[model samples]
Target: MLSSGVLAGSASVQGPQGEVAQFEYSGSMLRINAAQNDGYALLRDGHFYTVGYNNGQPMVFDAGAMLKGFGDMAPQAIHGDLGAEIASLKDTGENEVVAGIQGDVYEVQFIDDSGAQRSESLVLSTDKRAQELRDALFQMMNFAESMTPGQEKAKAQSQDIRARLSSLNAGILRYGSEVTVTEISGEPVAAQRFELPAQPLDLQGLGKLFGQ
Candidate 1:
């Protein structure tokens, strides 16, 4: 799941699936700068868009609508009950250095496919500033993810997420499949980035375009 894809930066690969993928984001936006095309963007504010070139002309539209038009072909949604998903958190008390930062280690223990318990270590800085960094990002991301379907259940799970964030007490410089997370820049992201660049072409008559 590319659920946390926004923060992943540029990547280049050479293989059968070789392509270049880049990401840019604020709290509300995520864009995948992909090869063979400009890329796509997913907005938490109920919008999705794809960018492409037509003799260098820009094309951006509501991707969520496009995906919706796919009906059953829309990507399978992956979800979990966060409370039932985790067995428990175990503090390893181990320390590791990442990008010249020292921090304590903790594990998010859970069950494997075989139904056996397993764990992965996550490093969190003890520095107060680092903790603040973690807190702010966690808060925003928590609110965003909560926007997914399952409102009542989501509300309950979001509470758990917030508590976990507070206890973690540091910005996650890394997580499962998270490429790289640098320090917080405190920069203001433009809200317009979430808006569609051009008037969207309605999918009603555009089935052939998207292979629907």
Candidate 2:
């Protein structure tokens, strides 16, 4: 259920040292500004680009190449699915409020391609406003997964999760201690928001700096 208009939101991801990464997203792009880092990523016409600052100057690079290089460096073959599929959801009979919206809590069980199981609690809202943000997020995720190599299984898994969530007529407010949605709004984002600010620096040249 992709939204016909742009939607924006603020979110945070919990990390070690109690750190949080700030995120802002529209349907077509996602901007991440974290400690010591600032960047935005987008997929256009099946090409992925990461635009960020280096020495306070804007630069763009091939995100897919960077990810593929990382994949090749792995010592062992990755086994489980990168995106896990939800196996079940059970109401916890609890409720929580986030960003001024109330939601129901549910315990969600997930299984990876390797049959590995894990569980987490999620706060989900059926609020109409949240649904718009959820749809935008789904679009962003799809673009990300499509650009990564060898993500076919993971993509399918992600789609299943989206379908399940939609069937519940809910949007996620919080997922365990990892992520939380702080605010959401339907706004028209400028097209320039996704445009690269400067010409892309060749990945080859960038790698030379690190002697890669």
Candidate 3:
């Protein structure tokens, strides 16, 4: 295991969620420091818990505090791009609004001071950046879905595009830090499971577009 307080690699965020923020992992701890007033949580032992938040708000957790389920519950299948989106918003407080367009969606939700929750939805097309990424990912999924069995060429192409998108790091958008893509029963599947950092990040100014 790594020593305590080791400076692991960093990741940034982008899109509507704000900045990339910094992430550090050392020993048995993982830390996420957001650029704006953002926050993050972890799923351990079948429970989801908010380990830290920007702006200094006391953390809270329920018996089952996981994010929306992806496997069967996701609006669409979750993949590397989706992982990037989640990491980007990992620190942007609860969303206060949400919207979707033609299968693309945007949501803004947040927990209030009294613990009440509020959210909104809009046609995802309204946000250029959000719509572009959402559409692209959805298009990839749609293509995969529509592919007939034994269409190896098309499947290969789709995975190529997905990997290409996963490589771009404009700001703090982090994805694929530890990703596994495989073929399961003739279907493509991806998983995001990795250790996290244990300290806050300096989101003010980040270096390099994307690291090696």
Candidate 4:
């Protein structure tokens, strides 16, 4: 529905600790600058880059390995594709205003990779502006999924969901309680915003920091 060009926006993400995080996206890149932490994350070009500061020293690392490592440490029972959990999506024929945009409400049913059932609600709009923003967000999601390990099944499921949404000419305005688009603009973003501030540290360099 977007005639052409890129969409820029910022969202408010509710953190687990009752704190809010700002998420900015432009084109295919998303940036999360932590407000209370010494690190930030950027998702660009099919990779997630994490930058952290230790005693005023900056360290850049690949996020894929960190995610895999976290998965390895988790209990096996919870090791499932979180992205492939959505089982169905249905329009509820209800309208709601989110962030000043009116959109139709939809219910999403989820069957976790472990087969547990859950559900959530989302507000979707068919506005051209919203569609442009949605496309940018979708691109980031695709890039993030591409870099994740062992996600082929989840990727397939995600593709199906994307197709279904596209068929309805819908774009997300709000996704349950997790994300809300607080502001949007058609402004141009600089290419350098997606560039890494420094080279990522190699595995050896990372291990050296821990005296491994």
Q: Which candidate ranks first by lDDT, i.e. highest? A: 4
TM, every model: 0.54, 0.73, 0.27, 0.72
> What local lDDT score does residue 97 receive in model 3, on the 0 to 100 scale?
24
Alpha-carbon deviation at 152 in model 1, angstroms: 7.6
In lDDT terms, how accurate is model 1? 0.48
Question: Could you tell me the TM-score of candidate 2?
Answer: 0.73
lDDT tens readout by residue for model 4, 1-212: 23256567665555435566656677667777677885788887666788888888878887644444443222221223325557789999999987677999999887875789888888898877567666765765655554344545666666766776688888877777666666555555566766787888644344333322
Residue 36, model 2: Cα distance from true site in angstroms = 4.2
How well does candidate 4 score on lDDT at residue 209?
A: 39
**Once superposed on the true structure, which residue ranges of model 3 sit more than 4 Å away at CA?**
1-7, 16-18, 27-29, 43-48, 51-57, 62-65, 68-71, 74-212
Could you give candidate 1's per-residue lDDT for residues 32-139 as a string of tens digits?
445566556545464556666588776766555544444333322322323224567666888876545677776777554356876656666655444444443443
Estimate the lDDT of model 2: 0.64
Clash pairs detected, candidate 4: none
Misplaced by over 4 Å in model 4 are 1-4, 15-17, 65-82, 85-87, 114-116, 190-192, 203-212
RMSD of each: 7.2, 4.6, 19.2, 4.9
How well does candidate 1 score on lDDT at residue 139? 38
Error of 3 at 88 (Å): 26
Q: Candidate 4 lDDT (Cα, whole model)?
A: 0.65
Q: Rank the candidates by lDDT, best first.
A: 4, 2, 1, 3
